[model samples]
Target: MPPVPQQHGHGMESPSIFQKSEMGAMMGGGVGLTIGFIFGSWSIIRHGAGPRGFMATLSQYMLSSAATFSFFLAIGSVIRSDSPLALRMEAMQLQLSASNPILRSKAESAQIVRARWAEERSRASN
Candidate 1:
Protein backbone atom coordinates (compact mmCIF):
# COMPACT_ATOMS: atom_id res chain seq x y z
CA MET A 1 0.00 0.00 0.00
CA PRO A 2 1.17 3.50 -0.80
CA PRO A 3 1.68 5.91 2.08
CA VAL A 4 -0.87 8.69 2.21
CA PRO A 5 0.39 12.24 1.91
CA GLN A 6 0.09 14.40 5.00
CA GLN A 7 -2.21 17.37 4.84
CA HIS A 8 -0.61 20.73 5.60
CA GLY A 9 -2.03 24.07 6.61
CA HIS A 10 -5.13 25.51 4.95
CA GLY A 11 -4.60 26.49 1.32
CA MET A 12 -4.10 30.21 1.72
CA GLU A 13 -4.10 32.45 4.73
CA SER A 14 -6.58 35.33 4.61
CA PRO A 15 -5.22 38.82 5.09
CA SER A 16 -5.03 40.25 8.57
CA ILE A 17 -7.98 42.34 9.77
CA PHE A 18 -5.89 45.51 9.76
CA GLN A 19 -4.76 44.95 6.19
CA LYS A 20 -8.31 44.29 5.03
CA SER A 21 -9.63 47.36 6.82
CA GLU A 22 -6.96 49.55 5.29
CA MET A 23 -7.62 48.25 1.79
CA GLY A 24 -11.35 48.72 2.24
CA ALA A 25 -10.86 52.27 3.47
CA MET A 26 -8.64 53.13 0.52
CA MET A 27 -11.04 51.68 -2.03
CA GLY A 28 -14.05 53.32 -0.44
CA GLY A 29 -12.31 56.66 -0.26
CA GLY A 30 -11.33 56.45 -3.92
CA VAL A 31 -14.89 55.61 -4.97
CA GLY A 32 -16.35 58.33 -2.80
CA LEU A 33 -13.90 60.90 -4.14
CA THR A 34 -14.87 60.02 -7.69
CA ILE A 35 -18.58 60.29 -6.97
CA GLY A 36 -18.20 63.50 -4.99
CA PHE A 37 -16.18 65.10 -7.74
CA ILE A 38 -18.77 64.29 -10.37
CA PHE A 39 -21.74 65.52 -8.34
CA GLY A 40 -19.92 68.52 -6.95
CA SER A 41 -18.80 69.62 -10.40
CA TRP A 42 -22.30 69.16 -11.79
CA SER A 43 -23.86 71.14 -8.97
CA ILE A 44 -21.35 73.95 -9.23
CA ILE A 45 -21.82 74.15 -12.96
CA ARG A 46 -25.62 74.06 -12.88
CA HIS A 47 -26.04 76.50 -10.00
CA GLY A 48 -23.29 78.83 -11.21
CA ALA A 49 -21.33 78.97 -7.99
CA GLY A 50 -18.65 81.64 -8.25
CA PRO A 51 -15.06 80.38 -8.37
CA ARG A 52 -14.48 80.69 -4.64
CA GLY A 53 -17.83 79.23 -3.68
CA PHE A 54 -17.37 76.37 -6.09
CA MET A 55 -14.01 75.50 -4.65
CA ALA A 56 -15.20 75.60 -1.07
CA THR A 57 -18.34 73.56 -1.64
CA LEU A 58 -16.55 71.02 -3.77
CA SER A 59 -13.81 70.54 -1.20
CA GLN A 60 -16.28 70.19 1.62
CA TYR A 61 -18.37 67.60 -0.21
CA MET A 62 -15.32 65.62 -1.27
CA LEU A 63 -13.83 65.45 2.20
CA SER A 64 -17.06 64.67 4.01
CA SER A 65 -18.14 61.97 1.54
CA ALA A 66 -14.72 60.34 1.55
CA ALA A 67 -14.67 60.26 5.33
CA THR A 68 -18.14 58.74 5.50
CA PHE A 69 -17.24 56.12 2.90
CA SER A 70 -14.06 55.17 4.71
CA PHE A 71 -15.87 54.69 7.98
CA PHE A 72 -18.49 52.36 6.47
CA LEU A 73 -15.88 50.47 4.50
CA ALA A 74 -13.77 49.88 7.60
CA ILE A 75 -16.77 48.59 9.46
CA GLY A 76 -17.66 46.23 6.60
CA SER A 77 -14.08 45.00 6.43
CA VAL A 78 -14.06 44.19 10.10
CA ILE A 79 -17.33 42.27 9.79
CA ARG A 80 -16.06 40.29 6.82
CA SER A 81 -12.79 39.48 8.51
CA ASP A 82 -14.63 38.13 11.51
CA SER A 83 -17.45 36.39 9.63
CA PRO A 84 -18.16 32.63 9.58
CA LEU A 85 -18.76 32.48 5.85
CA ALA A 86 -15.29 31.20 5.07
CA LEU A 87 -15.52 28.57 7.75
CA ARG A 88 -18.90 27.44 6.49
CA MET A 89 -17.63 27.18 2.93
CA GLU A 90 -14.64 25.15 4.05
CA ALA A 91 -16.84 22.81 5.99
CA MET A 92 -19.13 22.38 3.00
CA GLN A 93 -16.17 21.62 0.77
CA LEU A 94 -14.97 18.95 3.17
CA GLN A 95 -18.41 17.42 3.46
CA LEU A 96 -18.80 17.33 -0.28
CA SER A 97 -15.26 15.97 -0.78
CA ALA A 98 -15.62 13.50 -3.63
CA SER A 99 -18.55 15.39 -5.13
CA ASN A 100 -16.46 18.52 -5.63
CA PRO A 101 -15.74 19.04 -9.30
CA ILE A 102 -12.12 20.03 -8.78
CA LEU A 103 -11.45 17.08 -6.52
CA ARG A 104 -13.23 14.79 -8.93
CA SER A 105 -11.08 15.94 -11.78
CA LYS A 106 -7.93 15.37 -9.75
CA ALA A 107 -9.14 11.94 -8.74
CA GLU A 108 -9.74 11.03 -12.36
CA SER A 109 -6.25 12.13 -13.31
CA ALA A 110 -4.75 10.11 -10.46
CA GLN A 111 -6.68 7.05 -11.59
CA ILE A 112 -5.24 7.40 -15.07
CA VAL A 113 -1.72 7.59 -13.65
CA ARG A 114 -2.32 4.53 -11.48
CA ALA A 115 -3.65 2.57 -14.42
CA ARG A 116 -0.56 3.43 -16.46
CA TRP A 117 1.64 2.40 -13.56
CA ALA A 118 -0.17 -0.93 -13.31
CA GLU A 119 0.23 -1.51 -17.04
CA GLU A 120 3.96 -0.83 -16.78
CA ARG A 121 4.25 -3.23 -13.86
CA SER A 122 2.40 -5.97 -15.74
CA ARG A 123 4.59 -5.52 -18.81
CA ALA A 124 7.76 -5.67 -16.71
CA SER A 125 6.53 -8.81 -14.96
CA ASN A 126 5.76 -10.51 -18.28
Candidate 2:
Protein backbone atom coordinates (compact mmCIF):
# COMPACT_ATOMS: atom_id res chain seq x y z
CA MET A 1 0.00 0.00 0.00
CA PRO A 2 1.08 3.59 -0.63
CA PRO A 3 2.21 5.60 2.37
CA VAL A 4 -0.52 7.76 3.86
CA PRO A 5 0.19 11.45 3.46
CA GLN A 6 0.81 13.25 6.71
CA GLN A 7 -1.13 16.41 7.43
CA HIS A 8 0.95 19.39 8.52
CA GLY A 9 0.11 22.38 10.84
CA HIS A 10 -1.29 20.17 13.62
CA GLY A 11 1.61 19.98 16.08
CA MET A 12 1.19 16.31 16.90
CA GLU A 13 -0.74 13.42 15.49
CA SER A 14 -4.02 12.76 17.20
CA PRO A 15 -4.57 9.48 19.03
CA SER A 16 -6.73 6.87 17.38
CA ILE A 17 -10.33 6.70 18.62
CA PHE A 18 -9.64 3.54 20.60
CA GLN A 19 -6.62 5.09 22.24
CA LYS A 20 -8.62 8.15 23.24
CA SER A 21 -11.31 5.94 24.75
CA GLU A 22 -8.77 3.84 26.64
CA MET A 23 -7.01 6.94 27.94
CA GLY A 24 -10.33 8.35 29.09
CA ALA A 25 -11.08 5.15 30.97
CA MET A 26 -7.67 5.01 32.59
CA MET A 27 -7.85 8.64 33.66
CA GLY A 28 -11.38 8.26 35.01
CA GLY A 29 -10.40 5.12 36.94
CA GLY A 30 -7.33 6.75 38.43
CA VAL A 31 -9.34 9.78 39.59
CA GLY A 32 -12.11 7.59 41.01
CA LEU A 33 -9.68 5.40 42.96
CA THR A 34 -7.82 8.41 44.36
CA ILE A 35 -11.02 10.04 45.55
CA GLY A 36 -12.31 6.79 47.03
CA PHE A 37 -9.09 6.14 48.93
CA ILE A 38 -9.07 9.64 50.42
CA PHE A 39 -12.69 9.42 51.58
CA GLY A 40 -12.26 5.89 52.91
CA SER A 41 -9.16 6.86 54.88
CA TRP A 42 -10.93 9.86 56.34
CA SER A 43 -13.97 7.83 57.33
CA ILE A 44 -11.87 5.13 58.98
CA ILE A 45 -9.82 7.68 60.88
CA ARG A 46 -12.86 9.67 62.00
CA HIS A 47 -14.80 6.59 63.14
CA GLY A 48 -11.78 4.98 64.88
CA ALA A 49 -12.10 1.66 63.15
CA GLY A 50 -10.26 -1.47 64.38
CA PRO A 51 -7.84 -3.18 61.97
CA ARG A 52 -10.45 -5.68 60.73
CA GLY A 53 -13.07 -2.92 60.33
CA PHE A 54 -10.60 -0.75 58.50
CA MET A 55 -9.85 -3.52 56.05
CA ALA A 56 -13.58 -4.06 55.42
CA THR A 57 -14.24 -0.41 54.90
CA LEU A 58 -11.29 -0.07 52.57
CA SER A 59 -12.46 -3.04 50.53
CA GLN A 60 -15.94 -1.57 50.16
CA TYR A 61 -14.60 1.76 49.03
CA MET A 62 -12.27 0.10 46.54
CA LEU A 63 -15.13 -1.90 45.09
CA SER A 64 -17.30 1.18 44.74
CA SER A 65 -14.49 3.05 43.03
CA ALA A 66 -13.94 0.17 40.62
CA ALA A 67 -17.63 0.26 39.71
CA THR A 68 -17.54 4.03 39.10
CA PHE A 69 -14.44 3.65 36.94
CA SER A 70 -15.99 0.86 34.94
CA PHE A 71 -19.09 2.98 34.35
CA PHE A 72 -17.02 5.85 32.99
CA LEU A 73 -14.98 3.46 30.86
CA ALA A 74 -18.13 2.09 29.27
CA ILE A 75 -19.43 5.57 28.62
CA GLY A 76 -16.15 6.65 27.07
CA SER A 77 -16.02 3.62 24.82
CA VAL A 78 -19.62 4.14 23.69
CA ILE A 79 -19.08 7.82 23.00
CA ARG A 80 -15.91 7.22 21.00
CA SER A 81 -17.55 4.54 18.91
CA ASP A 82 -20.81 6.36 18.30
CA SER A 83 -19.69 9.73 16.90
CA PRO A 84 -16.69 11.81 15.96
CA LEU A 85 -15.90 14.65 18.38
CA ALA A 86 -16.63 17.39 15.86
CA LEU A 87 -20.11 16.04 15.18
CA ARG A 88 -20.86 15.82 18.86
CA MET A 89 -19.72 19.38 19.45
CA GLU A 90 -21.76 20.61 16.51
CA ALA A 91 -24.82 18.93 17.92
CA MET A 92 -24.18 20.44 21.31
CA GLN A 93 -23.73 23.91 19.85
CA LEU A 94 -26.90 23.53 17.87
CA GLN A 95 -28.81 22.53 20.95
CA LEU A 96 -27.33 25.41 22.93
CA SER A 97 -28.15 27.97 20.27
CA ALA A 98 -31.64 26.65 19.91
CA SER A 99 -32.36 26.82 23.61
CA ASN A 100 -30.82 30.25 24.16
CA PRO A 101 -32.25 33.20 22.23
CA ILE A 102 -29.29 35.47 23.06
CA LEU A 103 -26.78 32.99 21.74
CA ARG A 104 -28.83 32.42 18.60
CA SER A 105 -29.01 36.14 17.98
CA LYS A 106 -25.25 36.47 18.18
CA ALA A 107 -24.36 33.31 16.23
CA GLU A 108 -22.05 33.55 13.25
CA SER A 109 -22.46 31.68 9.99
CA ALA A 110 -22.20 27.91 10.42
CA GLN A 111 -18.94 27.69 8.46
CA ILE A 112 -17.23 30.43 10.46
CA VAL A 113 -18.48 29.11 13.79
CA ARG A 114 -17.32 25.61 13.00
CA ALA A 115 -13.86 26.76 11.84
CA ARG A 116 -13.33 28.86 14.95
CA TRP A 117 -14.68 26.16 17.19
CA ALA A 118 -12.38 23.56 15.66
CA GLU A 119 -9.34 25.80 16.01
CA GLU A 120 -10.08 26.61 19.63
CA ARG A 121 -10.89 23.02 20.48
CA SER A 122 -7.57 21.85 19.04
CA ARG A 123 -5.69 24.52 20.95
CA ALA A 124 -7.41 23.69 24.22
CA SER A 125 -6.95 19.95 23.82
CA ASN A 126 -3.26 20.37 23.21
lDDT of 2 by residue, 1-126 (tens): 466854434764555666657767777777778878888888888886666788888767866886698678857775755334677787778777856543443456676789988998999999
Tens-place lDDT per residue, model 1, 7-123, is 335755456678779989998899888888888888888887666787798987788888889889988988877434678898678867886544457788899899999999999
Which segments of model 2 are wrong by more than 4 Å?
A: 1-13, 50-52, 73-126
lDDT of 1 at 49: 68
Q: Residue 68 deviation, candidate 2, in Å?
A: 0.2
For model 2, the local distance difference test gives 0.72
For model 2, the run of ten residues with the poorest summed lDDT: 98-107
RMSD of 2: 11.3
- Against the hidden reference, what TM-scores do the models get? 0.53, 0.45
Model 2 TM:
0.45
* Candidate 1 stretches greater than 4 Å from native: 1-11, 50-52, 82-126
Q: Any idea what lDDT model 1 has? A: 0.79
